[model samples]
Target chain A: MFSAMIKKELLLVFRDKHALMALFVLPAVFILIMSVAMRDQFSSKNLEFSLFVKDLDKTSMSQEIIKLITNDKHLVQIKEKGDAQFFIVIPENYEQNSNEILKLNVQKSLKENEIEVFKSLLSEHILKARFHYISQSIELYSGKASKILANLEISSDKLYKVKYKNSKKLPNATQQSVPAWIVFGMFFIIIPMSTIYINERKQNTLMRLNSMNVSVFAMTFTKSIPYFLINQVQVWIMIGVGVFLVPLFDTPALAINGSVLAILEIATGLSLAAIGISTLIAVSASSSEQATTIGGILNLLLGAVGGVMVPKFIMPESMQTIAEYSPMAWGLDGFLDIFLSGANTQDVFIDFIKLFVFGLVCLGISMIILQIRIKKGL
Target chain B: MIKISNVTKTYGAKKALDNLSLEIKEGSIFGLLGVNGAGKTTLLSILNALVEMDSGEVEIFGHSLSKEKTKIKSLSSIIPQHLAFYENLSVGENLDFFAKIQKASQEDYDKAVSVNALKELMKQKASTLSGGQKRRLNIAIGLLNNPKVIYFDEPTVGIDPKSRNEILDSIKNYKNFGITVVYTSHYMNEIEKICDEVAIISEGKLVEQNTLENLFLSKDNKSVNIEVVYSNILKELNLKLLDETNIEVPKEQLCELLATLEEKNIMIKKIDYGSTNLEKYFLKRTGVEDV
Candidate 1:
């Protein structure tokens, strides 16, 4: 009996061309589009940075420092004040050894004749009495430092060393877009699956099945198997194609296999959810339109929240946390782990298990609700 | 054989089938007759174990409807009111698929002649098949299950006359093969023609049950006819005061009413007997004339 049900489901899925596009073509299209979009993000490129110097002391040393800072390819010196987005301020006593010199040490790096002129000018000041031994001592150190600096200083100074950090450029839209497309495909395929089941009830097909000695569980599970298999194969094909198109980090087989497994598992669970929802809707509806509308709302809500339309990464942290609660997010997360993270099957074991359990729970609820609804003649 | 006791089904405040008891014998074509919203389909659904009842004990072939649902499901087949095949699949594929669901092995196709013949038609897409052909497919699907009992809910609805006859014949054939048939329909003539016994349900209650012949013969209500220039008299007649079937009016009032009708420019073209057919009988039973 189970075999018969399986055969029936397979036939139904294969017969509809629209279902084929949704299950097979849609996922691959999404993978292609997203990968292409994100292609740039994964590339190896150095980030370009511009530096601006705001020198309070316009000394020859400051000029040398600016030349050195501009030497690195990654860092460019912006001469125009308005063009400079960031500035590094150099304090007047920045290089001073504070322990030895409590005063500003501008004289320590200046010429001997200039220091003597500075001392003679200070002696002739109106506040000569206030020039204590601390001031005289600073002048003596400045005169000695200037003579030493003339010998130690090189003709050209290398003041700053600019090293650029390695960065991977964001992939273009196609590569970045594929995963989201896969999610969309998953959602798109569900429409037919939901309608197929709901239409059965509307057209009295389920009632006919009920009369046929086929258990409800068998019917529901069997119907999902074909969809699961189709989605699994499509996910694998998409991943395989993606590996060739985008410079995927993971091997084709591992990536395709693990991601396929995750996708299939989630598809199965989601299909069960669809069946459960359809059964409940079909009871109240005398027409297929009602069922389709209700199913559409559910698929849309799940798809939107679960990252089919927008990737979860860009969403707020709180939204990402909420997305984890959605079934689609779990599926997408598992796939991404396998594809992008190069994770093995064991990594997705929990996700698959959760999805499987979700399927079972949905099916159980569907059966109970079906019983109640049918009894009430809704 | 199917048996139900104290079955009740309600939707909010509206009772669909209230304390209904019925027994459908094996190897007979039983017709369930009722007006729209009269609980015929509800009763069939319950019997098929497709839905549960509010309070009921149902037994099919000695298996409890609730506890032994799987067994019951295996024993029964249903031909629904609409086409049930996967329109995308060819006829043969559809049959093969349904047969597999019923656990009827393809290797044993030769053993089930009807199913094998149906399978041969699998090349044709279900949507491409004629209406009669689709109906036949529906019946053929039931045979795959090899059910002991089958329910046909308005099986010939919207079908051509020839197709209707063919479906009825097919149903009879099933009965001849000893499969219990529970046929539900609002069409009185079809029930009178095909069903050995008929049961009338009204407003969720089983109002009458007997052989088709006896149900029509045992009418106990006064039949009255009134002619008027305008059809508005029907709305004016307060039908609520009457009992289940008969209308009560004074003789002098009846005469005066006829005289008033004649005095007006109303021409009494003809006066015919009321409550003449199975439909009228149902209306009388339900206490609503506009069937």
Candidate 2:
């Protein structure tokens, strides 16, 4: 009986072209559009920023420091403070007074990621200037200190590595967009899922099944399995877009840095969560229009808060904390753990648990609601 | 067989079912006649255990309704007024799917299709079928469980007369399969033609319940028209004339009025009488003209 029911559900899902497009194609499109559009955002190597430097002393040392900051880099030295993202001031008699430190101020509205990049470059240049300053004084180059200063390779410093601690591979734009939008699209299962459920309820198919000894829980469970599988398929389709399609537009391909099992765990957990919410709304609302509007608005709100629309790393600390509470964020974080940090299933256990528990609660509530509605002959 | 005792349901301040009790015999086509919000649906829902009565005890086939819900579900099915099957599936698929829900054998699946004359339309989507065909499909799926009792709630409504006749015949045919049929409708002719027994409900209470023959017994109606010879005694008897030839008199008074006319030396030409003038009986029983 369950096999036949699952087959029926599969047939329904396969036959609904609009649902198929919403579930699969929409995420893949997002991955492609987002990855290609924001290609240069994640790669600091190609960033263009300008530095405003005021050499108060007009000395050779400050000149050398300014030259080092802009050497072979796109960080051009600008005379106008308004045109520069980084403002550097060499205080009076800085070469003479050891207490006078280089004062650097950044533009107020720069994104945190862009600020971190500028800070890394500035730190590297300052250290290199110290090396050149020490080399000029032969007395300071004595014993071990002389050897360490002389051997320093500050000129070619690998300043700010984007890779997480104890992990390999710098996550690029496609890597982030693919998983982020895949989670967003998976949550959209509420749309088609609620639609089918509400249709059944309104058409009295549920009443017929109830009369035939079919429990509401059984129907909900049967429905969840098929959509969960669809979500898995949708996940891979977006991955395929990230790996093959996005690169067609000249962006780097998505790198799978962890085991496939990690992806499966998060995908299944997130799918259940999506299905749970869908079923709840399906049985609760009086009409399909109500379900769609409520579900659509809910998904949009979750997407916004969960950092699917905006990366959490770029959000402020407080907003990121709020994002951690969203189920979509849990899904996104789980995928990022695998895709960006090469983390395995054990590493994503927290996210998986949160999603799994949330899903079970929603499904449990939906089952109760359905049973109540049926008992009331709604 | 189903029996109910003191079934009562209330929605807020309004009583939806007021101590309604009814017995539906096995292998009998029972019709429930009522106006809108007349508790027929509420009674049906209670029978199927789709609802819980505020106060009542119902037993079906000797099994307690509340305790043996699963048993009742397996033994009964309802053909809802709405199209119940998945519209996206083919007729064959719907039959197969519901049979699976019942865990019935392949024979049950084949029998449902054959019984409803759906064999030719098996490949067609339910949504593509005509109105009458869709009604037939509703019955076909309901029979998948081989239910001992089936309920039809206005199954022929909103269809052409030809299709309505087809559906009524289809429902009447269920009696051959020995499935108890509880049909609800507003059409007086439909219940009169098909039902073995009838129940009239008004405002959530049973106004009447009896065999169709008994409910429409001539002895109980005052509108049984008598066709008698042209006579001035009918005027003296204050008999109501349905036309010049027909005199509307109570069945009990018909003979008395005729004898009076004979005593008056009026020549008798013809007379006509039998049973039910069901529309009037229904209206008089329920005190409502609409049902």
Candidate 3:
């Protein structure tokens, strides 16, 4: 009986072209458009800050320091004055006098955060050059290179390294935009699901089913199965768009670095959670109009608060705290953990559990509402 | 067979079914007649176990409805007033889908299709079918379980005359297969034509219950309308006037009163006998003329 009900629901949904478009096409288009449109904001590798170098020392060591500064990925070299945001001055005999510190003069027009980043990058290179000069002097004076290196033993890895497992580079626009919009699209299943449910009630199909030996649980589950499957399909379609379609516009393709099974597991959990929420809205609302309206608005709000509209990293701390309570946030985080952070199944285990629990809770609430409505013959 | 006793259902402050009691024998066509808010729907819902009763004992096929809900549901099918099938699915798919839900065998599906004469339109979507064809499909779905009893709520509400007749014919044919049918409709003529027995409810209470023969045959329940040239004779005779010149007289009292009227030399232009209709009986029992 349950299978038959699900089949009927699937048939009805497949027959609705409008619902199909909303489920599959809308998210793909949005992801593609947003990824291409905001590609620069996501990829910061190409950004460069102008830096003027005044090499007064003119020694080989000073030239070496200049080479290090010019090799910086984020800084572009400027020869003349007044042509850069900041100027680096290597004072006379700066390399000979190892205790002397290089001066960095900046324009007042630079923003405070920009200035900080600029100063940090320049200071890192200068400190590396000084360490190199000291290592060379020690090798020269001791005349035993192996002993001097072993005693110093300093390396760049000691300065900064990730201790956790499965860490990767940050995501570009396509990776973040794909999953966020997919989550948004998955929750929008509520509109169509609620509309179908309300139509069943209005047309007396629910009463008919009741008279046909179908329990409320059976009906709700059967009705929810189709939308859950549709959500999974939506997820895959969006993933496909991110992998194949987004890169066509010259933006970097979304890469999934973690285990594929982990991503699929999270997708399943998120689908269940989304469909459960849709079922609740479908059964609880008074009319189709109210159901669709409330479902759409609730999904949009969840999308906003859950970091789908904007990255949680940029949101206010209080709002970020609130985002933790959203199931969408859990789902988006799980996807990002796999796509951006190279996390495996165990890495996102907590997110998957939270999503599954949230789905069960919503299903429980829907059942309670349905049972009460049936008892009261509403 | 179905029996309902002391069934009372209340919706907030309004009483939808007030101490209602009824019995329907097997293989009988029973008519439930009432106006819009006369609790016809509430009664049907309770009988089918779709709605709970605050106080009642309902037994279907000798099984308690409250305790054996699944059994009762399997034994009965309700054709709702509105279209209940998915419009997007074809007629065949709808029938097959409902048949599977009811656990009906392939033979049962074939039998339903043949009985309803829906063979050619099996591939047509329900939304594309005419009103009467859709009504037929609805009945076919109700018959999927091969239920012993069927509850029909306003089956032929808005349809062409030909389709209405076809549906009426189909309903009447249910008795040939020994299926008990509980039919409700606003069209009194349809009730008078198809029902073996009738029950009239008003204000959530049963106002009258009788077989068609007894309901119309009882002399006190029947009346004759007499039309005279003017109202002077009716005033002299102290007979209540139904209109300007028409007076409603008891069927049994008509002959003696007409003889006395002839003795009084009153001219009788026309004497119209009120037809035995469920409408008249409903009006007389409920004290409301519209329904």
Q: Which candidate has the top score in TM-score?
A: 3
Name model 2 segments beyond 4 Å from true.
A49-149, A155-171, B222-239, B242-276
Per-model C-alpha lDDT, please? 0.63, 0.85, 0.86
- What ranking of all candidate models by TM-score puts the best one first? 3, 2, 1
lDDT top scorer: 3
- By lDDT, rank the candidates, best first: 3, 2, 1
Off by over 4 Å in 1: A38-180, A246-342, A345-367, A374-378, B1-6, B23-25, B55-68, B105-120, B213-291
Report interface Cα RMSD per prediction. 2.5, 0.8, 1.1
Question: Each model's number of backbone clashes?
Answer: 36, 0, 0
lDDT by residue (tens digit), candidate 2, A349-368: 88999999999999999999
Residue by residue across B75-193, what tens digits does model 1's lDDT show? Answer: 88777777887777787777777776667755444334363245456688888888878888877777776778888889887879988887776677776678899999766667777
Question: At residue A366, what lDDT does model 1 achieve?
Answer: 67
* lDDT preference between candidates 1 and 3, better one: 3
User: Scored by Cα lDDT, where does model 1 land?
Assistant: 0.63
Model 3 C-alpha lDDT per residue in residues A43-138, reported as the tens digit of each score = 896566898888888877687777877787789888776978888888998988877767888888888989888877777677667666766768
Residue range with the least summed lDDT across 10 consecutive positions in model 1 chain B: B239-248
Report the error of model 2 at residue A40, Å. Answer: 2.1
Q: For model 3, how does the per-residue alpha-carbon lDDT over B162-216 read when each residue is reduced to its tens digit?
A: 9988888889999998999999998887887899999999989988888987987
RMSD of 3: 4.5
User: lDDT tens digits, residues B1-291, model 2?
Assistant: 779888899988999999988998989999998898998888898888888889988998899998999999899999888889999999888888898879987787788888788999999999999998898899889888888999888888877899888778878888998899999998878887899998888888988888976665646654456666675556666668787767777777777877877788776565544333777777777787666
Question: Which residue pairs in candidate 3 have backbone atoms (N, alpha carbon, C) closer than 3 angstroms, thus clashing?
Answer: none
Candidate 2 chain B superposition, TM-score: 0.84
